[model samples]
Target: MASEKTDKSRLRRDLLRTRAALPEGDVPVNGHALARHALQLPELTGAHTVAAYVSVGREPSTREVLEGLRERGVRVLLPVLLPDDDLDWAAYEGRDHLVPAGRGLLEPDGPRLGPEAVLAADAVLLPGLAVDRRGLRLGRGGGSYDRVLERLTRAGSRAALVVLLYDGEVLAQVPAEPHDRAVHAVVTPSGTTRFPAL
Candidate 1:
């Protein structure tokens, strides 16, 4: 287990370094395109509720996509990271509902919802440092999303777990720890890429 953690740490560090070296503008542009594409996926179409993350740093900015979802009559839920690193969800009525949570991340200001509410979401848009063809995800080391995904999976629902990234950030392979959650698909500026059959 220790060796596995070490391997994941090294791989995560390397991937972060590689992502940091990418051209800045390319990241946001790709992220925006990917978010737009995700909205078109069958998993998202007609889904009344969706869970999305607020992009920070190189993570894709889903603000426009969320607003677009609202315009299409889909209710959006944004995750708020708590002190214990667990996710508390809130409804995203519009851009004005966002308030800085911490570390420059923004979240909706409203009633907090439980994990069940998140599980009810038809699609969950995840943020990650890197994702591989097998759907292994390398997160920012917080492990919050990993835990949340595990909870969602254990609930017996096949909520689509989609990771947004720049085209280059999708790696050939990513070291996975026992606690790491595999994403269902990866989206980039070019198009949506489904993962290997799980």
Candidate 2:
């Protein structure tokens, strides 16, 4: 456990440095490509409900993707962070419904649909620093998505877990912990990579 933590900490620091060093103009272009790639995923297109987040900072922006999904008549659910860092879901009604929240993140301002709302989603978009060959994801270590994934598992939800990443963030390997869950796929700017089910 101690070694895994140490490895993740180092990997997080290194990935953040690389993301921070990216040219400012690259964010929007990559965001656009991310949206395009996400739409190309058959799971997303067939999904009636998609649980996603409002990408902040250098994280590949989901602003375009969120709006795009809504335009396609998909029921888009955005996360509302609880004070304890657990996530609740809310319906997305375009960018107007989003309000600034903690951690400089934007969340839906509608009624909270409870954390378990994600169980009904056909797809779930996760935020992460990097994902490895085996589909292990390295999040920011906040333990937020861990709880979300755990909730989905406990309820036996079949949501297609997905993550958005820059092309380079897809590393060859990353430290995996026992409690960690593997995502089904990741949509990078270049294209989408699917991990075979374990």
Candidate number with greatest TM-score: 2
Question: How would you encode candidate 2's per-residue C-alpha lDDT over 1-198 as one tens digit per residue?
Answer: 999999999999999999899888899999999999999899999999999999887889898999888999999999999999999999999888889998899999899999989899999999999999989899999999999999999998889999999999999999989998899999999999999745
Model 1 agreement with the true structure over 1-198: per-residue lDDT tens digits: 787678778877877787767677866676668767978888788688889887766566676678788889998899888889889899997888899988788998899987567988988888887888788888877878878887887888778888877777788887776666677888777888897536
Pairs that clash in candidate 2? none
Q: Candidate 1: which stretches are off by over 4 Å?
A: 22-24
lDDT of each structure? 0.80, 0.92
Number of clashing residue pairs, candidate 1? 0
TM-score per prediction, in order, is 0.90, 0.98
Least well predicted 10-residue stretch by lDDT in candidate 2: 189-198
lDDT, model 1:
0.80
